[model samples]
Target: MRWDGVHIAATGVWLPGRLSAEEAVAAGAYDADEHAANRIVSVAAAETEADGGPSAPEMAVRAARTALRRAGAAAERVSAVFHSHVWFQGADMWTPASYVADRTAGSGVPAFGLQQSCNAGVSSLELGARHLEVGGAVLLTTADRFSGPSFDRWRCERGLVYGDAGTALVLSSVGGFARLLSTSTAVDNSLEAISRPASPVADPSEARRPLDLSALADDYVRANGDPRRLTLRTAQVADASVRQALADADTRMEDVSRVVLNATGRSRMRWQLELQLGLNEKMSNWEFCSEAGHLGAGDHFAGLDDLVRSGQVLPGDRVLLVGGGTGYSCTSAVVEITESAHRPE
Candidate 1:
């Protein structure tokens, strides 16, 4: 949706140390041939909380603290906290969003959790922008760690590697560093089954099986006919989302200084980015994303943080962020940097 007077005051990202593809192959955690084919350099791996490391919510807390501090946003000024994630957040049937809000914005503001799959980050941003229409600031945070028995970061899905990260963006209706020009979303719900198993698990034993997106995708294609049909439809939807976002922002593809997309591997990146959106690889944050791997909902926020911190995008440069999730939904947003900020040392 097109918006006015909504600005991104600051962004923060907490990324753990890297786990190189070579090390993963040597440890038999990754296949060398697959690594070569996907062309991923490394992925961010988080230390387990059982080993005295921060859990997913703690990571989100860290990122939120940084963003709050950077934006000079006080507790009373924040209207709500919106947290998003993909994997289990340390416990079952607990509210991680409340925890994030308690630690960052105090207990006064209401907390919400969004589950829009990988698109939840940008989607939350879109929602938060609307919340600003009612007045106070909104904090958007996303965190995920792909480390557990239920998921194999390297093998859970084909042409993709999962990474662990926490990201936060503070949006204010008052003023900030960048102006949020517009946001748009498109959905093709028929494609949701592409990530669902043909048969739902009936037993507890069956439910614990590791996620195998490749098998699920195969099942969908086998049942629905050709896979190309899925690809074509996805591309068309994403293209329309992008076109509308740019149009709403009164900006063109050629006018954008950068594009940030999901942190998928090389082949899928080529298809969705260059071939589909017609954005040059250099103009996109593919290099940084390849090294960090797919960071669930943290992809867009972390990428934009990197661009600002690294000085890759200057003031007045417009940035386009495109995100898609397993629900077969796509969200695109346009942001225009209004001024420079002090880069953390």
Candidate 2:
């Protein structure tokens, strides 16, 4: 849908220490052949508080403060706070969004957490833009630490390496760095079983052991049909979402200067986005994503922040943010930078 006055006031990101893929291979934590195939060099991994690292919510607070400061927005000025995550956020059934809001944006803001898999960041932007009124501001944050006995960041899922990081975007009706033009989302429920466990259960312990995604995928294919059909449908939906977003923004694919895509493997990136959209590999943030891995719902936010901070995006340039989540949902957003980021703060 088209947006009228919503703009991105500022963005902030916090990435923890990184672990090289080669180091994982050397330590027998990852397979050499798979690493070569994925073409990922390193992934951001979180450290304990004893090592001076922050928890997921703490990182969100840090990033939110930076974004709010850059936007010159006081805690009282924030009307809402939306935090997204994909893993256990150091607590069970606790309100991390409230923690973030109380610590950064104040106590009375309408703060809540969302779980849309990896698409939550972009989805939050879309939702926040719709919620904003004249002169209102919304704080959107995403953070995840993919560690522990339940998940292996390096081997839990195929074709993607999970990362630990926090990202924030202060969006406001008041003008700032970039204008949000349009956003769109699409979903295919048939593919939902791909991420669902093979057997349904009332308790967590009743679920399959190890939570093997590969096994779940195999079961989905066997129960449904060939997996290629699913891939084709997913690519079609993703391409359609991008086209619709651009159309709503009154722009075209050729007008987009940058495309921030999901931090998946090289093959998936090539097939799902670049090749499908006829876009050059250089137009996407693949090189940076290779080093940072997939930061759960924060990939697009972190990627956009990198583009602005590195001077790759300029005033009047158009950018396309696109990604999908395990719910078989795809989303895309079109943004136009309104001011040169090179100007002194």
Candidate 3:
């Protein structure tokens, strides 16, 4: 949908640290061949909370604080807070969004949490843009910590490596750094089974089993026939979503200065988006993403932060952010930088 009054006021990202792929291989936590195939050099890994490190919510708060400061928005100025995540955030049956709101944007801001897999960040941005009124501001945050006993970041997925990080974006109706031109989403519900648990939902034991995305995808492909056909369809849908977003923004593909895509893998990135959209690797944030791994829903947000901080995105530059979630959902957004922010050191 086209947006008239929405702007990306500021963005912030908080990464714990990086764990090299070589280190993972040396520790027998990852396969060297697979790491070479994925072409991911490193991944952001969070330190244990026992080391005085921040938890998921705490990380989100840190990012939010930075974003709010950059936007020059006080806690009371924020109208809402939306937190997105891919895994558990410390506690069970608890609301991390409320905690984030209380710490950053203050109370009674209608804070809430959402899970649309990796698409949650962009999805929340879309929702927040639509919810914003004149002069109102919305705080969007995404965070995830993929540790042991629940998830093995390096080996959980086939061609993708998960990372631990928190990202925040302050969206406001008041003018700011970049204008949110448009956002679009497309879904293929039939592909949802590709990530579904092997066991029944009634059994929670299935959740404890080390996540095997490769096995799940293989089973789904075998049952559905032709894996190549499924891949083609995904690429087509993603292309269509991006095209629609560009159209809504009244821009052409060639007009985009940068593209932020999911940090899946080099091969998948080439086949899925770059090839389908006729974009070169230079137009995408592959170098930064390769080091960070997939920051769940925060990939696009973090990419935006990198682009702005590195001064690759300047005033009047148009940027495309695309994301695909495990629930077989795809989303795209077009952003136009209206003002250049100070580059980070």
At residue 295, candidate 1 shows an lDDT of: 95
Q: TM-score winner among the candidates? A: 1
Residue 223 in model 2: lDDT: 88
lDDT of 3 by residue, 1-345 (tens): 999988898898999889998889999999887888888989999887887777888889989988888887433478899999998899988999999999988877889899899988988878998778546899999998888767889888888899999999999987789999999998887778888755547756646467678878888888889998988877777877888999999999999999999888787777655568888888988899789999999999999999998889899999999988877888999999988886653
User: Which is the winner by TM-score between candidate 1 and candidate 2?
Assistant: 1
**Per-residue error at 132 for model 1, in Å?**
0.5
lDDT of 1 by residue, 157-243 (tens): 888899999999999987888999999998898888888777777764777358878889888888998888888998888888899
Q: After superposition on all CA atoms, what RMSD does each candidate show versus the true structure?
A: 1.3, 1.7, 1.6
Off by over 4 Å in 3: 74-76, 206-208
Show where candidate 1 strays beyond 4 Å: 74-76, 203-205
Q: How much is the lDDT of residue 59 in candidate 2?
A: 82
Cα displacement (angstroms), candidate 2, residue 215, comes to 2.6
Model 2 weakest 10-residue run by lDDT: 69-78
lDDT digits (tens) for residues 1-345 of candidate 2 = 999999999998989878999999999998887798899999999896667778888888888887888887433468999999988788887999999999988987889898889989998988898878646899999998877567788887788888999999999987779999999998887778888866678987676655567778878889888788977888888878888999999998899999998898777677656578888888898988999999999999999988998889999899999978878888899999988765444
Candidate 3: lDDT over CA atoms?
0.87
